[model samples]
Each structure stands twice: as structure tokens, then as C-alpha cells.
Target: MSVTAAEVLIDTLHDWGVDRIFGMPGDGINGIMEALRFRQDRIQFIQVRHEEAAAFMACAHAKYTGQLGVCLATSGPGGLHLLNGLYDAKLDGQPVLAITGMPFHDLIGTKTQQDVELDKVFMDVAVYNERVMGAAHIENIAHLACRTALSYRGVAHITFPVDLQDSEVSKPTTKRNVPNHTSDVFAIEAGFPSNRDLDLAAAVLNGGEKVVILAGRGALGASEELELLAERLGAPIVKALLGKGSVPDDSPYTTGTIGLLGTKPSQEVLEECDTLLIAGSSFPYIEFLPKPGQARGVQIDMDPMRIGLRYPIEVGLVGQCRKTLNALLPMVQQKEDRSFLEKTQKGMKVWWALMEARGTNQSTPMKPQVVAWELGKQLRNSAIVSSDSGTIATWWARQVPAKADQLHSVSGNLASMANGLPYAMAAQLAYPDRQCVAFVGDGGFSMLMAELATCVKYQLPVKVIIIKNNTLGMIKWEQMVFLGNPEYGCELHPINFALFAEACGAKGLTIDDPQHCAATLQEAFETPGPVIIEALVDPFEPPMPPKVTLDQAAKFAHSLAKGEPNRDKIALTVLSDKVRELI
Candidate 1:
């Protein structure tokens, strides 16, 4: 049977195993939408309010399911609106395909009403960008875009001209097929020396009295193997922020996350370890890594470039971490020494106990540490939480413990602000049965506040809890630490978030006192559909269970003694333990 370009487009997606396409229909893509009606059961279409939200949801779907998420849009302004979310997908390294409609071929450069070069605009963000000029090029170009996105695990764009999509094919076309199986061709081409490197890495871990294994999100599917290796070698595992709870937090080998916002136990333990093994973690900050000369380091990663990208690696293995670890397990001997492991565990226990003690006290500004702890208790095993990059992120990293089957989705590598709302939108779309909550700061929420309308329109039941501190708390802390005073940028104007939520047709709640915060959160969670709970916390309130610091304490004293106080008169002395111990 002769086929139209629109029919072939949907058919190609079905062949590629795309189960869902999140988008709204428009004039240019009406033909494609009509073609999708026949196969509604096999590939469902999720209609969203705006193209931006659709793209965000598509990106989240890919992250959760590890599939190539799909989104569609009309030409010009419609395609332009999708850029923010596409940028988010590209930065997060999620595999996605954005199919955009274009103006007629005859009017290519004649400056039509909505004419814009979508391919060139998207080139910088996506890994691959192409325009299907004719029906002859559709089959090959479509397959290439899909395969490139899947192989590279990044965004790919394909634009179809409106006239071309509606035109009938003159000649017969063959259906395109992409090979399902992926090979380790990257490793082979890179010429990674296997036998000798494995032997050397095995020897170093075996010989060292103290060894640490740090993993990241790249190690998602290999959590079990990681735990087994850690247990066998008596080496505890430290996770990157994204890798939190990759293994059950209660597991014996699980220490915590390592970074600037890292827990005291993780920082202290990593600092003391003599040998470090980095498995699939491409953490950006080199300072958080063990000093190059001090620790004997070995890195195992799927991407060859990431192996030695940041910290210097004594040995680099370019393969999946699980595969490389499987090969090395038999070559290495199990260590019987539990001295270092036991010591690290003891330190973690002590830190947790101290945090718990300090967090329980009732105070104004509602300690994020305590609030996050309470929220963690309320969290179900299936709850998926996403946090923005700020003081709120620090609270989530330190206080909220990880549970099995639970995932914390975030826009990493980019460290992008205003990601919490979009992430929650995607998580809700991906896992409809499970509860998805976004812990957003007021500043971060303001970035993409319009998404609330998207949530209401789709009836996605995502709970958004605003940590309303009325200031940019993280930047304020940075000012106190570096410039020796609070800066003008740290101040924030009060927002009526509950009223805003009401205007968007979503349930809303506001809590002023610390005592009512937990119950308010509980009510928000239980409310019918999409709900936003704004906890009006103290703007000048101290950070929850402040970090152990001597420099902070000295700065506090100097500011207090100044005739004209250089800093906010907030009592940070409550964070200090003993005078000499913290430094």
C-alpha cells in the first residue's frame, strides 16, 4: 500500500519501540496526529498544555525508563518554546527525539510569518540535528537520528517540512530497522589493555589497608554487583549525590554522598582512605576527590573520556563498571581486614546520632534538616523526590535517607536552577502509580512557576513542597564565608505561593509555625491531585543542624565584636561543638 509521510513517521516510531509521545497537536502536525489514532493502543499519545512541559515530561520519561523519549511540535514559535526543556534534556544526558514540523519547501527562505531555522538553533544543544528535505531521505535520516540518540544517550532533533509530510510518495520505500543490540566497540577501538591493568588494580586494593569505592548514577543497573564487591573486599562505598541510595542506605557498605555539601562522615572517611576506586562516577568537582598523589586510584566507566577527565587515574578501564568489576572479582582475593570498614561505619553512626539530636529541637525558620527528616519518614518506598540546586539540595543530601525502589531524579552536570518543578512533572508522568514530590526553594520555584498550569491541565498528581525561607540561603552562606558579610543578592521578596497555586487550579496550603509544618505536608500529600504546600519559614533562620566548622565560628565572633556588624546577627554559635575540635 502507498503511504503518506505522516503515516511513515508514526510507523517508524512504533518500530523503534516508542510506547508514548508527550505532546499537543497543532496545524502543521495534524496529519501525524491523525495517523497516530490507528495505533493508539500500541503507542499512546499524552496531550500536554504547552510544548515546553511536553518536552520536560519526555526527558523525565527517558531518565526513568531508559528509553528514547519522544516529543512533537509545530514549526517556528512552537519549536522555539521547546528549547528550554530540550536544553534540560541535553544537559541531563537523557536520550530524547524531538520531531518538529516545518514550513513548505517552496517558502524555505522567504521570511514567512513563523519562519525560523529550527535545526541551526537546536544544533548546539542536541548531539545530532537534521532536516528531512524529501521523502527519499526520511527513512535513513529517521533511523540515524534514533540510533545516534540511543548510542550517545543524548538529545536528537528531526524536522519534517509540512508539505513533504502531506505529500504522497512516488516510489516504493523500505522500512528501516535499527540493530537492537549494543556492543563494546568503544573499548575495542580505544585499545584498553585488559589483563595487566586488572592485575595491577586488584593488587593495590588487596594491599591497601583502607580502600573506598565511590559510585554514581551511571552505576544504576549494577547496584547489586557494587555491594557484593564492597562486601567481599571490606571496602565501604561512597556515592555521588545522584547515586544516593543506588544501594539501600541501610546496607553495610553504604557510607554516604561525597561533595561540598557532603556529610561529615563521607568527607572524613574519603579523606582518610589510602586507596580509592571510582566506578561510573564522573563527579565535576576535583577538590571533592581524593588528592591525586595521596590515594592510589583506579577508574572504571562506560565512556572512555570520563575515566581520566577530572582526577588523575593511575589505571583506567574503558567498559561498563559492572562488566569490568565482574572480570576483576575472580582475579582479586577477598580482604579479611574489617578494621578500616568498621571505623568508617562507627564514624557514620556518630554523625547521624549527632544530627538527629540537633535536628529534633523546635525552632523558628523551621530547620530544613528537621523538616526533611520528617518528610523522609512520611515517604513511601516508591516515592520519587527531586530537589533544586541550593540549600534545599544540601538538606536532601544529608537528611533524607534512601529506600529500595525509590529514585531521586535531578538535572545534574548542568546544576541548573528551576529544575525541581520540571523534574517533578516528568517523574509524575513516568511513574504515575508512585508518589513524586518536588522539594523546591522559593527562588528555584519562581524559575518555572508556569508549569503548575501544565500539571493541572494534565491532572498529574505531583506534590510540590516549597521550602519558603524567603531568601537565597546558599548564596547567603557563601557571602558569610568568603566576603565576611551578608550581600544584597541574598535578600528575597515574600511570595504568595498558595494564592498562586490556587490561581493555577491546584490545591494549596501554607504553614507558618514549625509545629504545623509536618501536618501541613501530610495534608498536601493526601490531597486529591496536584497540591502545593508553601511552608513560610524564617528568612534569617539558621540552616538546619549546621556543618561542623571552626572558620565559621571565628567569623561569627569577629562580626559580633565589630562596631558596625559586617554580617547578619544570626547566632551560628549553636553549630559549634568544642572550640578546638572542629577546625
Candidate 2:
């Protein structure tokens, strides 16, 4: 009997080093499911509650393992559900392969059930998207899809028609074109900028008196080179959220995060610098970046198009981060005056002091900052942390210190919620021995909490730290910041997440009092299996921006006058420090 297309595809994936696939079984994918059953020992199929979670797990798996993550879904809604998580991978620049089952080849254009045009649906998110037309196309398509995902460092997709999946390849085609699984077929090389561009970038850096280095995720491989360049130039390094682990947080010249979820010291460094040297970060939010003409900009990015897109560039160096930095380091001159670096370092000390004050506050309901800070201190060196988007992100971004060998991730460009749990689960699955934690808000956790059962089923010891504030904390704060609008539709009904976790067959703990914070967290971490620590955090604790402007203050006053709850608390915590600075 001839090998079916599904079997060939599965063999190709196994050859490509895909040990696992995350998805749910459906009639549309029966052929693939059967193939999985036959290849059970070779490739494991991780069943997830939702296809969205599967996509998220794949994205996180790719991020944590530095390998192409694979996910599958049946046709129609199931395939559509993968878009958000695929976008997360696309935006965050993780390599992922998404396989979707389609209706029978003859029924594709007809009004058959579960028949949807998947190529169009995934076109926006995928770097390479195609549909397999015949059994002869299976091996080549699979190879190309996997290769595209890995080489381009983005999402690649393949839609297999149900009829084609079960079809057998002709003997001649099968014999002439045997599947090849050699590692050399998937090898990719690092990119480097030309000498001319490197010279220009160096000249720009040497001309500036006060240089500020902004590192992004692209700079992860060049930490030593970045540190050397920063030290020689007397530049303060500020990290983009995705770039948090590129350099250790404790570096003498490292300013934490920059932007809305950033530190005042980072903002100060950007504001005072005469030159901005951005490395591998396509950080959006141009308002938070140095204003046009405020500083001469030198941007280093692998993509030539992204070099000057974010900020006006005096020099745009297009190459791999480490290679580019290595080349540019020799061309630039060492700075004689280290005053700007000294001043930024001093400002960082003050910013950290203020953060410690907030974290140690002995308030009634525990402050989220305190929880995050304590968690940071208790984390093992090999820990991987995944943060959900929202107020919890602020705590994770600012409170948690990035250390060497530690991994930190969030739904960066997409800023989607509910990704924390799936991300942590993937990290735990990828590195079973290392500690994995997900910091999620009450609102975000409710979106995909069903995945806790997946964690239980797999016995993945991923700890969840849910900041149960019973509110959409970030939206509530945004309403006050943007429109001075009073909180509306932002409140969430209180949930006993601990009970929910217990129901899902995982360990659970609820901390309502401030004193129980550490003990409960420690207990949850010690649990043998999946655990959830639902800390009822103070809802009134504001996620203040690095620099509060007069306009922001006016909006806050308007929100207070409009009878927003916790006005007094906001005034005490957020405004008091500003008031002190003014006085």
C-alpha cells in the first residue's frame, strides 16, 4: 500500500525536529489525526481546549526553545481562531507553523459545512501561506512551509484538503522524490550590514556627546557586544519590553523598560541624550521615543525597511544585531566625559527607590507591585515568566528584574490578554525542569482559564500568579488618562480563582491578607503539579506612567470630580510623589 499524504507530512515534520503538535481533533482533520496515532511515539499531539490556546502555546514554544513551533486546527472557525495567536507570533517575531484541515477538495467552493477559504483568512498573519492541491505537493509544501517559518522567523501556514490528505502519491512521484530530512536543508545564516553603512553608523555615534542605547528583542544574541559598546560610549541602555532579557537589569548603565509600562529613569535617559542608538527593536509608540530632531538617531535592524520607520534615522544599519554591533564598535570613539551616564544611573537609583517604596507598602489589600517584586526575588535563575497584557504587565515590566539566563515574554505588539497561561504552559512543556510562572490579571485569566485542565492533564508544573483585582485595571486607568472618563464597564465580578483551579484538578491558594502573600506564593511554588495563587490585589493601586504630564494630571482631576471610585487612593499613591517633586 502507498503511503498517504498525511503520513508523509507527519514524517516530514518529525524529520524537521518537530517533536510535538498542539491542537484539537475534529472530523476535518481525521486523516491527520490517524497519522498522528500511527506516529504517536515520534510526534506527540497536545490536545488543547481551544485552537487559540494551541496557537499561543506554539508561539511561546518557539520563543522559549528557539525552534519552529507547530500548531494545527480543523477548518473554518477552528482555523480562524488561530489568527490572534499567530499574529502574536508574527508581531513578536517567533517562528511558527500553522496547519489547518480544509473541506474535501471538491466541496471547497461549494456551500459545504466547515468550508471556508483559509488562505485568505491567514494571508495577513502568515509569511508563507498555501494550500496543498495534490499528494505530489505534500512533501515539497511541508518542507517549504517549515523552511519559511524558520528562515524568515515568522508564521508559515499550510491548508490540507481532507480528500488530498488521505490520497496516495503515485509510485513514480514517490520513488523519484524521496523525502529528505537532512539538517542542512533548514540551516540559515546570520545577516550583516555592509561596511559603508557600518562606517556611517560609527560616525554618527562618535559625533554625539550623550548617547542612549535602546535595545530590543533583536539584540538578545549580542549582550556582550552591547555592553562593551555602551561602556565605551558612556551610554545608558534602555530595554524595550520584549528586549527585557537582552541584558541583565542590574547592569550599571541599564535603565529598565521605556514607554507607558516603563521607568522614569529610562524616560530621563531618552530625554537627555543627544544621540539615540536603537538596536533590533521595532518598538511602536513613537510618542514615548525621542521626538523628531531631538536626537540624531542610529537604528540597527535586520530588516532594511524597519531601520528608519520608527524614528528619523541619521544612520540606518541593516544586519543581524550581534554582527552589526561588532562591526560598529571598532569604528566609534570612546567618550571622555561620562557625566550623562552617571546622571542616568543616579536617576535609576531614585526610580528603583520609589518602586521599592510602592512594593513594600503595608496596605490592606496587597499591592500587585509587592506581589510581583516578591515573586521576582523568589524566582530561580532558570525561571521563565510570561506576563499577560494589562496592569499586571506594568508590574512585571517594572518590578521584575531581568537576570542572565532568565526568559521574559508578553504579547508584545498585539498586546492581547489571556496569553499568559498558554505561554507559561508552553514554556513549562519546553523546559520541564525549569520554573515557569504566568502573571495574569483577573480579567485576562478568565479568557482562557480552561487551559488549566490541559496543564493538569500534562502534569506540567506551571505556577500561575493571578492578580485578582476584580477590575480591568489597565482600561480603568486608560479611561482616566485619555478621556478623563470615569470607569465604566471595567469592573469585573469577583471570582474565586483558587476554587476554579481546584475544580480543574490543580493546586490552588487564595491570599486576601497582606501577610499571607509570601507564604501562599511559597506554598503554591512548592506544589508538585499545576498551581494557582489568586492574590486579591488592591484595585486602587494605579499603574502610573514614567512621566506624568500636566494633561494627565488634569484628566485625573476630572476623573476624581466625576466620582470615580478610589480617587483618594489614587491621589495618595500616584499624585503624592508628583506633588513632592514639584515642592
Candidate 3:
């Protein structure tokens, strides 16, 4: 007697330390799902309404736990739906394994039902892509894909053909051999930064009138080292949104985030700095970048390819930031440019104060920041907060302080909308003892609202805060920025989210008054099961605080200040004092 391929795969997943999988069932994947059902106690298969939501859930699980997240999909469209969220995981360098269904090997070339090339569609976004053609290839391919996903720290795909899924295969008693990457292209000296690279970077810093530091997603892993580097150099640090909390905004060297939606200081520092040390981020906006040829740009990245991708580099050092920065710190000389760093830090402080002090008690519609900040204060230190892609995500990342025990997970690289609720459910389920909440926009909430049933069924305590503005806030803002007047098609109809949550077997509440936000949140948190609190937020809510580019403001004014245009009709005038003062 021989074990089936599906059973062997599930047993292997259990051995790989996977406690659960998020996926949807389909005819193509019936065999695999059935296998998963047999081990419901050892490895649970969490069925989600949409494959997109399932992928997002796996991403959150990986981010919170620092492990590989797994999601399954049926053939054709079901497999395709996983790409958007899987792309997010890949860009962020998260370890995610997407097991997708495909037509049997024989029918692949014939273009049978859902017979698209799954591996080909996924190759661009994943670290590795492989299809199991024969039962003999299962054990080796599965282990290889897993190792590749972990090694590259990104998404990997292993397509299981329907024909091969039920076929019997012998399981290896020991873990199979996994491939290793030994690229000389990325190799670095064993000791530290070469004397030459340090000499060049140090000379630039010593000679420059002002020095600034720009950190990106790559900086996430070496946050403490970055802080030390900033402190030693007395350079102001501005993180990309993805690099939120790389260092406390209050740190002496901190200067908030930089980009189109970035703070005034971040914009000003790039303009003023004679030397800019780029750390761990390939920030894409070329217009926001400083003069690469004349201005000194020193980059530190583990992947050599990313060093000079976005901007011209004066010194490109390939190594882990933590290790390389530690080695470079001693060899480099300190700068005495406290004036620039001081000015930038002071600007950030005043910006935050003005933003927070405004309309803490407005009578009309409540400020969005006020709601987010107040919720921030009420959240326990151990709570984990997830934000969907939108203005709300930016607000939470900026205003909500993540303490030692607290974790803040955002879809950075993929930066897609509607990930909040899915991430919230997964985070809460992963750490049931800790509180979990998702701050989502009206548009984002609806994207994954169907997952409410999954949360309720599992008895996972999670809270969802929906800013019901009834329109795509960020897109509306973009229209105001790029296009001259207000645009059509951005507006959306309002949803009775409270009714929807109740229908899904979870507690739901609606709050129109700003005064009751804290209390409403408290009651929701106290509820034993999942809860959704929909706040009919002001349509005229201010944009996320800090990091508004001068060009964006200028473009907006150029379009609107001419007259009370029709575009302004759709715009909400209930601006937050916090936002106005900061910009």
C-alpha cells in the first residue's frame, strides 16, 4: 500500500511547521482539500470567500510570525486571483508558498479547462516557480520550492497538476536536499566595509554642509543599527512609508518619511543635504531624489542589483546593513552638522504637535486623525494593528505607536487596498492572547468583509474599524493633485456594514458621533467574538499626516484655487487642523 500524493504533501507541510493554510476549494483541488480535511486537527484548512483574501491572510500570518505563509487556490481564475496579494508578499520579501491547481500534465498543452500555465504566470513575482509533472518529482520539488521561498525571502509557487495530485509517491524518510545560492555577484569581504568605500562615504560626510539619511523597506531588518548610525553621524533620517518605525520619530536623527505624500522636512532635507546615505530602500520616485551625480549618494543593500537601480550611486556597498554599518561606523569620521539635523527634527516635532493639537473636540464631523490617535491611546501595548492600503494605513503607521510587544503590519511592497480585515483576522488567530484590530476604509472594508464568517467560525477575537467615507479617499486626492477638478467614478455607494457583520455572525456597531468612538471601540474589543465598528467618517477628512510633497500641494492649488470649482463640490471641507498645520 502506498500513500497518496495529496496525503504526502499535507504530512510534509506539518513537518515544515505549518499549523494552518488559508485557501478556497474547487473541483480542480478537490483531492488536495480532501487530504487537508483528513488532518483537520493537526493542520487546519481555513476556507476564505475569495482567493485574494486567502493570499492576504497568509501574508499577514507570515509577517506576524516571521515564517512562511501558505495559501492554496484552484485552477485557472482561482489561481490567478492569488497573484495580486502574492505580489505584495513578494515585493516585501515575505516567505509565502502559493500551492495552485493546474490541469493534468497531459492536458496542459491542449488548453483544457483552467489549463493556463500557472508557473509562467507566477514566475515574474515569485522567487521560484515549478510544476510537478510526475509523482516521482513531488518530494524533491516540494522541498526545493519551500527552501527557495525561504532563501529568497519572497513568494514561491509549486503548481500541483490534478492528475499528479492523487497519484501515489514514495515519501523520503529524511528531509530532501535543497538547492543553495552561491552568487559571487553579491559576495562581500569577511571583515567589514572596505577601507576605500568608508573613506569615500566619510569624506562626503565630513565635507558636506548637511547630511541626511533615507531608509526604505530594506532598513526594516537593521533598525537598531540604523539608529546607531544616525546617532553617530548626527544625520536626520526619513523612512519610506514601508520603513515606518525604523526608528522612533522622536529620535534626534529622525525626520519623518519622504515621497510625494511625505513631510516638508523630508522634502527639504533631500534638497538641502550635500550627502544622502541610502539604506535598505529602493525608493522609486525619481523626481523626489536628489542630484545623484553631484550630490553624494551612498547605498547599502544586501542585493547588489538594488544598489543603483533607482538613483545614481556615488558609493554602492553590497552587504547586510547591520553588519556593514557596524563595521563602517568606527572607520568613518563624525560630522559636526548639528544645525541641519536639529532643524529637521524640530520641524517634525512641530508638525506632529500641530497635527495632533487640532480639533481634538470638533462639534461637526470628527477628524480622522483624532479617531485614529484616540484609538491608538486606547489600544493595549500587546495589541497588533493591521492597516489596509489607503489614507487610513498611512494614518495608522504615522500616529499609532507600536510598542515593544505591539506589532504593526502593513502591505508595503504590494501596497494594495482591502488587506486590512484579512490581515487582522489572521493576526488575531495567530496570537489569540493578544488584541488585534484593523483600521480600514469603507472601500477597503468591503473588499474582505466576507471573511467575517471565517473569524466568527474560529472564535477569533478581532476588531475592525471602518472609516466610512463612501468614496476612494486617496484616489480622490490624487485627482485633486494630478487632474484639475474633481473626477467622476471615484465615488461609491454606502454600505450598511453593521447589518453585514451581524449577518456574518459577528457583533457590529455604527457610530455617527465622534464623541462615542472610544467607547464604541472599547465595547467592540470587549466582545468575545469578532466585531466591526463602522464610523460614518467625514467625506472631507484630511489626508494622512506628514510627507505631503510641495509639488503635490502646488498642483492641487493650481487646479482648485482658480475658483470654487465643481470639483470642490465633492470635496469635504471638514479638514483636520492637524493636517493643515503640518502641510
Best by TM-score: 2
Candidate 2 local lDDT, 1-583, one digit each (tens): 6888999899999988999999988888889999999999999999999999999999999988889899999989989989899999999889999999999999998989987989888988999999988888888889889988998899999999988889887543545655553233764655677888888889889999999999999988688999999999999999999999999888897999999999998888888788999999999988888889999999998777788888999888877889888888889898999999999889988888877776776667678988988888889998999999999999999998988889999999999999999999999988989999999999999999999999999999999999998999999999998789888899999889889999999998988776777788888888899999998877888888888899998998899889987778776766654564454
- On residues 373-406, what C-alpha lDDT tens digit does candidate 3 reach at each position? 7777788877888888877875675566545456
Per-model CA lDDT versus the true structure: 0.76, 0.89, 0.77
Better of 1 and 2 by TM-score: 2
Residue 91 in candidate 1, Cα distance off native in Å:
3.5
For all predicted structures, in order, the TM-scores are 0.88, 0.96, 0.89
Q: Which parts of model 3 are misplaced by more than 4 Å?
A: 171-209, 359-361, 544-583
Candidate 2 residue pairs that clash? none
Ranking 1 against 2 by lDDT, winner: 2
lDDT of 1 by residue, 413-455 (tens): 7766677877787788777898998888999888778888888
Clashes of each: 1, 0, 6
| Best model number under lDDT | 2
